[model samples]
Target: MKKYFYFLFFSLLPFGCKDTNGKKPIEITTNDSSSIYLNKAQNKNTKIADKLKYYKKSFTILKNQENDSITRSKLFELTKELYKNNFEREFLSSVNLLTKLATKSKDSFYLAQAYRSKGSFYKHQATKDSAFIYYTEAEKILKKIKHKEGLSLVLINKSLIQFDTGDYTGADRTLNNAYLISKKNNEIDNLYAISVMMGLTSLETKDFDKAIQYFNYGLEIVSKNNNIIGEFNKETCLNNIGLSYQRKAEQKKSVEDYKKSIEYFKSALKNKSIRTEDPELYNLLTDNLGYSYLKTENLDQALALFLESLKIREELNYPNQIVLSKVHLSEYYRQVNDTAKSKKYIFEALSLAKKEKAYRDYLNALKQASIIDVQNASTYSKEYIRLSDSIRNVEILSQEKFARIQLETDEIIKEKDILEDKNRSLLYTFIGVVFLLSMLFVVRAQRARTKELMFKQAQQRANEEIYNLLMAQQDVIDQSREIEKKKIARDLHDGILSRMFGARLNLDSINHLDDPESVKKRLEYLNELKEIEQDIREISHDLSREKQDLINNFVSITTNLFEEQTATHSAKLTYFMDSSIKWDLVKNNIKINVFRILQEGLQNINKYAKAKTISVNFRKENNELHISIEDDGIGFDVSKKSKGIGMQNMISRAIDCNGKLDINSSKENGTKITLNIPLE
Candidate 1:
């Protein structure tokens, strides 16, 4: 009954957003009887729809069910279906529950998969920072589990995000990681992805021939396969190859390159049904081909193609593509000697480009403005040069970030990033010096005013850059601190190695030539000896158990932390413990929370407190245990309104244990933090 109504509703109701959607409306269809909704949702053959009714049903079922491995598998499928069907709200909602359930199930494989899915979600949202963080998380887990394919996919995702942010050098290194993984696995799909992305990186860096070669390689792989993936790759390779040629022509004005570009564009659009099948690509191809025709003096053909694409773009209401169409149309008019029409279109294109942030189109408009608007040519030329130089500097900064590429560790990336940052700063200084020398003789009256402003701006920029760098490096710094904890755990290997070897030797010794009575007696003796040995080991373990409890272990841990911290700073650190405090009687939960809070405090002090003396004390008073930390460093206002995660966590931890916590700080008096947990 629902199926009959689903088809009937679409037939009777008006198609939604037909003019602006570009793609045709989704047809009501089923891919499979079982998992029908999910299957159809992920089906490219069905176009796209939210299918909120089915989504809600899935979410309801998930909420009622136990979050076991089977449930996790089902949830993961729902996320995929939601993502593929363009249900962003539901996808984000589902991803959190899926990850939490995976974590609860204690399944590393599914947990890694969940994190990667989250990264994909954020990537689609264009939230690169969150996406990168999640991908790094997934990378750590997948690497530990030795899941090559999952790691490869995550790296590919990270590289794509890097490429989007203009981090071409990082993208190259990241793709190299995926490439190595793909080569090891001998997976054609993964290889195809790497080759194409590498081509894009090369293309962006202006290595046109290398880019073309990569596209050809991708094309070769697709031609030998007959899957749906191949069809998609074939079109992508054709368009990307065409784009590489188009860019080369734009750079060098090579007539042969433009001709080659036209051929590829025509090839990509050879299937006549593409206009209806994929109107978006059809529009892009038409616009690109028109531009190539305009470049080659085929004015009549160029004008018709431009008009067709322009009509399509306006109907589709894609402001970015509309700006692109207008830019191309302006060029067509300029080539035809229609100066007024060219001016009109270029000005409109510039306005729309600014509104849409279609920077490439904006540049094109500016360039055309300089040519067609003879009276204002100097102004347009100056604006064009300034924007172009700004873009170039941004690109340089991004590339310089990973100039010393080492993909082995986050530490390497951070260390190399800092080195490149210094290099970039020096480069800026050198450029500023050159500019200053050149400007010294340029209208002496304005030079002093200009220099002063430049100095102030430089100081501000330096401060901003420093803050941004610190924020970006926070994750890597946290990872380094975690290594300290792992270092302590790794020491256990030495104690267990000899015992494991002895046990293995005893197990391997079999009495092959013995009489039955003698073999049985020997086995009994061996079992008795093993039981005695285990009993001895248990006694030894229990004797040391108290020393490994949360509080005692914390004391030992903090000793190492304090020594390491003070050795690197000028501050003299002192820690005193109340010997009368009975840690064995206190719950581990309270002890763990206190330990974490102290760690956070020490970190903050190391980062922001330029203290000469730091005091950390744990004492018992009245009917409660008291802990206080005092640092004679520059302190912030106690009454300031802000969102600080560290402070919130400390307060929450104290509340969790029915404790009272207070923080007192002032600029003149430094800072003090106190915590009181009741003995009851």
Candidate 2:
């Protein structure tokens, strides 16, 4: 399985920080011992122990200082230096220091970068599980901030881990996602990394032509950088392309495809700059090209390349590459029919593969040994089968472990979303409850206010009724006093005074007359006295007599109200009262309330109905008093319940009179209010 590097693409986005300036962004004060030590520690020429001592001294001073932007930036500077120099333990400590400073400062960009750096360190240690965890954490932060370049690189690293676990499907999907994100931002470095990852996935799946296409695409982008990194990546692409063609050639048994593979491998080695810039790539190409030569029967060139690659690989002590080089050399000797030399190289390659745990290459070595050593061929073949099964089982277990990791990460994200949704729901519920409580409070307050207003209105109506009663009583008393005075004056003038006058005249003429005339005069005078006394008694009786009942009071009051309405409003009105009804027989309460209801109805007609003409009719029907007040005016809809106080007053008064009131009106038909009451 091939692993891809992605952290280099951090330069594409502002949020994706990288120390491309070769030093800290801030100036270091030379007055401080910490600054001087940090500067010396970052120097490439410093000894390893000296660098560690300086870094430790620098971090001691940094921990005492506040975690600010400048401090965190300096920590990042040191971390980048350690990471570049492959100082694993020092790099981890620097990453942790940066993380502490970034957390204290609440700097998400620096925190994510720290996480990515830590992941990169773990990847170097071949700790894929820890590397994937840190990369995922970094990705979570970068994605939220829309740091496309950084997220793309982290995703590529995760995909590479998937590739190592034989999760080609997961790797291809993640690689495509990384490719799209980088493509949107036009980030060339991230695109190249993802393209290479996709190419490796294709190569693993044996889609040789498709893998070559992806690697070729990566080569085009890397060729523009005229540096060691660009040259290294260029060789990687060319070597991977050659591998794809060589696999295709072996499958098809085509000499033509093999030549194509040789052409690409030779091109990768053509630039001598690559040999010195990236010695491992040069050595790898040399071995791979020699293997292709062995396939084509170019014995001289093949032998020379194989020997040179083996010497360099063994000197470097790279067991995996050394195993490959030795295996190729063994094959070369076998072709030349040097049986003893071939067995020697093949045995050494098998021993190294087992020690390095390079099982794929070990299987290859075992298969080669089984063919070369005929005496122990069965033993070699049996070992090959068992080792192949063990490797396959390991690959399956790795895939399961990585799949579980992916599932757990997805579950955490899902749980976070659910928690957010629940929080929102609780917020909305609280608001709804508060709103409902407020509405209830308002309704109670409104009800209290309405009840108070109604009580005051009832008191006012009671006072008005008392005042009307007093006025009517005063008018009756005034009319009685005037009648008494006129009657007294007429009795005195017509009878009492005239009789006294006759007595006085008689008394004066009887003075010279005899006793008989005197007696007659006295008698007459006495009679006159008796007549005056009788007249006084009659006058007293007349004064004590009850006043005449001239007309029904209910009719009089109703007529007076109707007259007042006509005079005040200056409108045509008609009022008819059935003379057959006994006003005296009706209870005063009924009369009073009916009168009030009629008064309210007429007032409503005057104030709102705007009727051209109105009629008030009172009739006795079925032992009930029927009163109808009609107004031919612009009317309101009868279907709608009226909220007007005037209408409510009329209805209430009618109910008080033990009557039913019906009001009908429409725009086309003017308003008519009818009241029916049991007269009994």
Candidate 3:
């Protein structure tokens, strides 16, 4: 025989703000003086009917005066608040008022809000299709405005419908969207609602661990808030956590989990907030606690709890809940071997379930009845199987429809996002195009001024060129003398110094020897001296050869200068010299001037450019030696900034080289200094 555990499935209700006058009410406390304050507050709340009548009269008076959108919207909002406790009649009236305000104002926000309120009203009436239609309409407008809070509420409402219709997959997807929006907006109430719904979804999917986590998180939120809805959610989460433990107990056959489930359920029932605010949840906790006791074979405690739950359900006249209670009682009687009482309770449960058309309840009742009704057990068993199959098929159909609607809704939202992105991109692109056009005009004007300045500077450059040539020749001469001195110093250190030391050692050794041995060692030392003299002669020949090989002109001077410049700074310098470029063929004056230009460019890069990398490329193209110096550095505006002395010197050197000097620079694009010289 299968044992059934009753679990509470709490539905999330929309929480509304209570409208009040701008005065703070007296605080209600546990003291005797506070009792009078609490009584006055109760009496004030009791006059809600009179307040509603006054609001209607005021609304009618306001409608005659201005008929303005703001005034009408305010009245609509006031009327909506007055109908919070009234479900069907007053809620319908609020929906009408909202619709009228939306039409008059022609505002999408008002229209969307109206649709949402209508959806809520329809949802409360259990007209799910109408509710879905209204929710979808509201969602369209809310998504258009990117109203996350309203969209989240709509999603939560739609998910509830999906959940009730047994579309767990669809409901889970919808709730996930709602949860993200609520979390992002920090909508605590919506977050509490979504979290609890997610727990229930987890429960349905048999994901007990996730269910427990979600329930605990929701309970934490409720504990901090301590409002009417918060208290309700707290009780709901408590009940859900107990249900989770019960399932875990059943799965693992754990006695400890059952005891824990009982503890949570009892705690939920004892909670003052839950006890005072939520009778339904209180009864659910009682029934769940009884099941937990039954799991541990505490029959007396189980029976007493079950009887209390049944009494509450009976008083409330909730047929489904009453059926659940009777079913549990039947199971309890069967456990204690009270065959007649078990049969009696099971029949009563079946009658109630059939009246309510709760097929699951009816099936459960029949299955239990069959256990005791031996002879007619097969008939009852067959009927239960038939009903279960029918219900399963209906649920499958509902899920398919729900999934299709969800897919369409998601696609619509995706398309809206795509459209928004495209619009934003187009706007940015338009702005960029306009900016580029303006920059083009500015660049053209700058180029014109740069060309005029370069033309005027050309004549002055010629005079500077002659003076630079004479100075460069002297520098080259000085560098050559320095190179020769270094070579002579190295030759002396390696050759003359080594021979002198060897000769001293030989003499010292001769002193330690006898007369004949000393004479022999002296002769050997003399031969070594002769060999050293020959080595010295060879060194002189090598020096002449090195002088012949050395081309201490433009290429050599430029390479040496580049090395020195890089050694002094952190910037990296790279130079490329084409093998085909014959440095000897190039005129000395031209080479010197080209080298000077390159030196000046490098100096500028080191001092002002703040460059990381600089490259110098020397290549012969069509009898022209092309020398280009480039740096990845912060460049100056060639048109705006006047040429400095260094730049003028570089231009003068290029003029003396009989080459064209082209300088390309921009603020962010770096600088390229190209000097094209004729080799022929």
**TM, every model:** 0.51, 0.57, 0.58
The segments of candidate 3 whose C-alpha lies over 4 angstroms from its true place after superposition are 1-12, 15-69, 82-90, 100-106, 224-228, 232-235, 270-278, 416-434, 450-680
Worst-scoring 10-residue span by lDDT in model 3: 1-10
Query: Model 1, 430-522: lDDT tens per residue?
Result: 999999987876758787778989999999999999999998799789987785444223222212222233334444454453777657755
TM-score for candidate 1:
0.51
lDDT scores of the candidates, listed in order: 0.72, 0.77, 0.73
Residue pairs in candidate 2 whose N, alpha carbon or C atoms collide under 3 angstroms: none
* Candidate 2, position 222, lDDT: 86
Better of 2 and 3 by lDDT: 2
Off by over 4 Å in 2: 1-36, 100-107, 224-230, 421-680
* Alpha-carbon RMSD, each predicted model: 31.8, 34.9, 20.0
**Cα lDDT of model 2 by residue, 217-313, tens digit:** 9888787644323346777788889988988988899888889999999998888986676677778788878878889989899999999888888
Q: Which 10 residues in a row give candidate 1 its minimum summed lDDT?
A: 1-10
Candidate 3 structure quality by residue, lDDT tens digits, 1-680: 10122123223344342222123522323243223332332355657666555555544544454545454455445445545646356556656766776677666766777787787777777787778778888778877777787788888888887777777788898899888888998878778877878887788888988989988998898888776343455667787899999988989999999998988888777777655566677777889999999989998999999998898878888788888888889888889999899889989999989988888779888888888889899999999999989988887877776566667877888998899899999999999999999999999989977987888799789879988999999999999988666545544543355445647655875676778868877887788787767667766766432223233555565666678667556889898999998778766556545654665677578657889998989888898888888999999899998986556666766776678999999997789998888878
Segments in model 1 whose C-alpha atoms lie over 4 Å from true places: 1-54, 230-232, 385-409, 412-680
